[model samples]
Target chain A: MDTRPDSGHVLSADRPGRFGPYGGRYVPEALIAALDELDREYAAAKQDPAFTAELDHLLTTYTGRPTPITEAARFGAEAAGGARVLLKREDLNHTGSHKINNVLGQALLTKRIGKPRVIAETGAGQHGVATATAAALMGLECVIYMGEEDTRRQALNVARMRLLGATVVPVTTGSRTLKDAINEALRDWVTNVATTNYVFGTVAGPHPFPTLVRDLQRIIGVEARQQVLDLTGKLPDAVAACVGGGSNAIGIFHAFIDDPEVALYGFEAGGDGVATGRHAATITAGSPGVLHGARSYLLQDEMGQTIESHSISAGLDYPGVGPEHAWLKDSGRATYEPVDDADAMEAFRLLCRTEGIIPAIESSHALAGARRLGERLGPEATILVNLSGRGDKDVDTAATWFGLMDDSESEGGR
Target chain B: MTTSVAFEKARAEGRAALVGYLPAGYPSVDGSIEAIRAMVEAGVDVVEVGLPYSDPLIDGPVIQTAVDAALRAGTTTKDVLRVVEAVAATGAPAVVMSYWNPLDRYGAAAFARDLAAAGGSGVITPDLTPDADDTWIPAAREHGLDTVFLVAPSSTEERIAMTTAACRGFVYATSVMGVTGTREQVGDAAAGLVARTKATTQLPVAVGLGVSNAAQAAEIAAYADGVVVGSAFVRRLLEAPDPAAGVTAVAELAADLAGGVRTR
Candidate 1:
């Protein structure tokens, strides 16, 4: 009966069903049995020392944890107005993003739960690529749904996922994008309820998902918080991260939510501009509604139907925010702002030029927000920006956007 | 009399009926009301007033957009119920088609009583089953409203029998394997499903999903007692932009489909 001796590390015995004000089982009746099974398995796995040791080995050898908290001295000097800037350097993580942390944990959990097939929905394809990588390493059958448009734009990532032995399904419904991919994935899950474990990529979805992903990803904040404090002698004036379903933001901000001295800001993508009816600023312009299995801030019509959302960054190009992020916005625990495509692109280029760090276009939204906050805080404020991912994956898009590639030439090759 | 008694009579008389669907206040609340009025005037046997939720998983693009417009227009469950009451005042048979959460939130039993009192004849929770039927069905029957059940082509023989036994007004047979509002033609597959459902139950089996036009409706009516066309009507409403005109247009279409029914 006591099968889960390995789960002691992740879930605290004191608070077995909570993650701050977030996380709980808020799904439908049909998923109750599967969720209960998962909860039990997860509990047992945390208590298993062997499971912990193996996971630790993967974190060290595979994911490259204790990722450097590098001082972006030159970039910081300019951004600080005199204050220092510290990068959590999650960009250095394998697969070049913090997305791997959650993917690896879930892949391990998938095996523990005895599920042979893993499914995920991808927008920017970072999470898809990460999930595909984990599945190939563990040899689980993997299926990833990407928007048809994203499949084309992020072709290399599609190839990457295929190379990792995952089936890449191009979702061609609704907007033929991320939201539709989510719809298709949910339908797949409902159909394959008995045989599959959906490796949800971010801190979103119904109940346990937002909690599960945060717990898996908390390592980033746990390490970064300590690393930053040790290096700076105090908490930074502000913490900034981009909001694509708010995973990385929550990962970093959860540790500092109770820190009264630190201000947390989440940057949303304002595509062309908020007024142009094009943007993914759900927290800023949306209301609470059920989407992708959870009640969250969603861009929707009054009848509760999902509305078309736009964002220059493909990862942030979704119509709904994670449920906890909605709660945070409603409760005023965090402030969210929209950074337009132009500003984010400028910041993307600026960071590359000044710090030699090419961040994902999604991460550049955070950098754009940091620049504004830096101006407001004025020379006396230190900001810890979560350089959440590297930009190699986005190079082709960046090249075209910046006109670095010839208009007539096909520019996908590395 | 119970709504189920009416369905039994309809089935016995060998007279297939029509059930029209419209989002509450789609073009506008008034437009939706006019559509219902037209449906009643146009001889619709039943009207399914949809309580729009944000994400309708089983719906195609057209109905989804209609729902979006309705929600944008500030339509709520309470507002939809008011629309139901308004339609009921016209003496048209009304059924509320909705997801379970809103019904659960409103207290299923309480909702049943209020809806029955307000002139609604039936309740169709699209996602519920007989085993899980206790959540709303008993309360609905207690309040004198019929609790309809749905069966798809994928339903097992055992499931069809179970659903037929538990069903009240009529059994709704989803003709296709996909969502509502799809333009995929309703083929012989739907006809086959209707025949199968008929074998399982003495109750009238109404075919929905992919029954977009009068031709499809006539085709479906050949096998089933009735055909449910949601997206086609919603599409008309979407195009006309005026709710009354949209309803009249759909009512005309419904009449055309009803005219095509041929009994053996």
Candidate 2:
């Protein structure tokens, strides 16, 4: 029977891992037992003080959690309608991104499941690098799947993952990008489930993943909330983050779902523009369909073939969005908008010049959206943006875009 | 005329039914039809016309390569139905095995109606589960088409029972814990999974995935009601020098598999 809409499945009630009509196990039956075991493990992990203490110790000593919030005064006054913009400095964390938050949790869960190896699929390789790092830390065997095209485009991250002692398999099937990488990773998981854990990187996959990753990454908002209060004496008027598969956005937004006054804005990658039909603006331009694992908004053709998504930011170039964002958008708890490649680059350059903080291009979408939201909410509003990662991984793309790198350097002929 | 009729006739002969799968428009829409026709003529009891999808996560490299070729050749939902129509014209029970999206995109009710009108028997969803589904069951039910759901080796007793209850034509036991590919040996878990599935429902239980040879087919047929072979047939076409050769190769393989089922 079709039940009524899920009333905030995560914090409100113990849902069957559903967010309204979105998010369910739309996977093959083979993984159901594993998913159930993961669900049970995560639930128990949440209650067990030993697990929590160990995770907390890792977060503090190893991951350097409870990251600080910096006020972007110069960038705010110049670009954002003079609104107070506060940046949640997830960039400064050990792996240089908020991805470490969830990766560490799943790596721990992988160990708890008694599986000694982990496999992960990556788009731009942020999650892949993070997963590789955690696997190395835990002394577990790790394998990373990246699309062939992406492996060439993101060679440095490939190097990083390799340096961390993970095998990098270049997937040649399908579009040979993030989508195909995920497909290959799922195939690997199905074959090696008895010994390996598919360390899902985002909140977009089936069942417990959307819920599980969110629960692990929610510390972004959980910590941001208290940190913002301790600094500002009151909650911010709004929260903003970039949405690809929407792990970081969902991570930052979960703690704010109950705060009705705080408007949540997710910035989708508008490659050229949504109107031009070349963008990854799933929530803005997509119809609800199944992709990856969960039923969510996706770029699909009339016959349901997944249309390739485009974005200058490789991390944000995904056809399907997290199911929670779909639910949040439909339920009117959040608003999603597209930021064109040019606008995001403009913001990317602006943040580096004004705040001396180079943000991930994926996070640049959120920064660009905040400027728009600041204009809408006016100067009186306080906006907290989750700078999900540092820009070190994105320097090459940024250098080429801004013409900072000459042709010879980019071409590698010199 | 239907899966039940075909399967029952095979059962009456004291042999497990041979099920063959070939994706629509693999070489071309017409060439795909020819391959399945060869399969049926060579003694494949049931024809499973695969509807190629953009994201085929349940498939291995062999099927994925074939599906990609089909998509590149402009295989559409309509072409898949056309293939089904051609296979059914042979008086063989034909079913379209597809992922959920294309059918969902074509409108589940509409696709079901189109398939029924096409003289098709049912759909076999590799991804969609009975519990996860909302629209497909009703649409298939309305069109008098069977909804075949898979029961994996890792499926719990509760899930197996629920999956079988929601299934109509026959249950697809995924035999292995992984996607579609021919393994060196059939997983030992297949027989136990089939026996467990049989205890729950009277519907014939067909074993799919990793069955590459007649020996493997015979092994599965010893316990299963039907032996489903896909990648092996697709691999022949993938490696064929010519379309006609692919059809002949598929026919040869199908005949060999058919023999294996009977001997068992």
Candidate 3:
């Protein structure tokens, strides 16, 4: 509905919620007081320049804001087919991913709200690590919920979070994955609403979260949009990124939502292929349903039970997506497509070999999609790709996938 | 000697009633409909089918599992309505219990209207305040649906009175200090809350949280006019190897639990 600020939908202490059809405080009765407190605090915090300045200072000084917009020269020749391609270097952010943007903002907000405990759920553990990093920086008690399966697969990330002084709780129930971990985290929030703030990692879930995360991440788009405008003399033809829960994609897409001239493309993980019944292309293959706390496209059976989704990249493996993406897909302002594991991996190798930039497996999906789109566009067309996170944490997995590390070397923890 | 309709009629005979708890479809969708149906059939008085979202920081394990399953099953507001409609088709009085996002997403006024048309008798949004009820409650009332609110033991006596007046249904009296489905015994504390609430308003006060088995249900029923057993019924459905059988089995337990609480 009226999502614009002029429409009187702008957030206020009185209306600290209401994000079009996207945001509001959807919580348990027990936490109503806490939510009201947070709402009051966040509204004031939003108005406080000191809060904004402190966050801005940290984002710039600590998380390394204004990350480079590097043009993929050699990789552009191959993937871009001689077209201009630039990458917003969020990988250079502290903790090696764009997840730092939202975490830092939420941590600051948590403090302002006087909540001492921070809880989050992670899949690939990138968000967990970033949250742990923020919690350590803010000196907040952090509890991270991870799927039992993800903890084992992303052991380095697990270790990294522990190193940051965050307690990692392995969720063994349900699918034992990101969705389940989120469920567990919600349980904890419901149990400890007074002292805890749930720091969601994506631009999804019920109202305020999707909007909040996007606002926090909007820096990526704000910076990238400005960088592209300054560098290319105009906005790029398309802004493309991968969509697991649509954080980075929304991060880069939000600033350009009203910019009709700029096309936004979100690439989802297609494990083998969408046709192979092994993929996480929820926006494409899924029908309108609900999952993970919001109404959105879901990969569900006839009875509306969520079906298991698969992807080689652990981060991209989920059955549902953020509701705004569903709106964007329906409205056709943005388009979501899929890139298979083999294609993403191929792009990963090509980017590394040509540009010396090893992209995260999740980001590689966007790179792969950009490569396909760039070929169709003329050389005059410029495309901006949100390089959502770094690949350093993925080296071990990449090494195994590319057969770079020997068995013994691969066995050693990075 | 008594039925859900009779109990519901009896409650309306005096004034509105309130029932609240986290349900299975809230975090998951598979057993959500069954849970709502079972609660309704068992004479829940008014069903709060929690549409599970990601950041439910206030629910206990049973409710958490329900939310998890709702999320995993990809349950959303539309699905919640679909479930509600299915249960409403049974002519059961119900409420679409959820966080504000779904109501906002579906358009609060339209959602309330649709819920009423679908036979939803009321709403129990713990997050929505009386002052802000202008956002959706007007529309909710326009749709022939009541606005149910919550009052906890920790709530001030003034808050109890204000919320009771704001509420169209009974005041949802929390039996314990924590989220839904945490206590083994509701103890004297819940009974004391019920007495305090009764002193303030004539509205029905249904006690939930930790009231699972028949004995516990009967225990709480001794003081309060109505009793809500959520996690126990949800756990029955979830732990059941077969979902349909789980539905039937949970319905039976609800039958037993409701029977224990029913005043003949």
What local lDDT does model 1 show for residue A169?
99
TM-score of chain B of 2: 0.99
- Tell me chain A's TM-score in each of the predictions: 0.91, 0.95, 0.92
C-alpha lDDT of all candidate models, in order: 0.77, 0.91, 0.75
Q: Per-residue alpha-carbon lDDT of model 2 for B97-135, expressed as tens digits?
A: 999889888999899999999999999998899888689
Worst 10 residues of 3 chain B by lDDT: B15-24
Compare candidates 1 and 2 on DockQ and give the better one.
2
User: A137-185 in candidate 2: lDDT tens per residue?
Assistant: 9999999999998888788999999999999999998778899999999
lDDT of 1: 0.77
For model 2, name the residue pairs that clash. none
- Tell me, by TM-score, which candidate is best: 2
By DockQ, who's the top model here? 2
- What does candidate 1's lDDT look like per residue over B104-174, in tens digits? 55677888988888888887766565654345768876887777877766566777788788877788888
Angstrom error at residue A119, model 2: 0.9
Best by lDDT: 2
* lDDT string, candidate 1, A61-131, tens digits: 99898888887778766654655667888899998898998888888989988889999999989999999
Could you tell me how far off, in angstroms, the CA of residue A160 lies in candidate 1 after the best superposition?
1.4
**Residue-wise lDDT of candidate 3 within B1-264, one digit each (tens)?**
112453467456542222434353532454566666665666555566666654444456666666775676656567667776776666556666665545655677878877776666677775554644456767876776777777776566776777777777666777775766636668576878888888888766777778776777767766777777667776776677777777777777767776666532
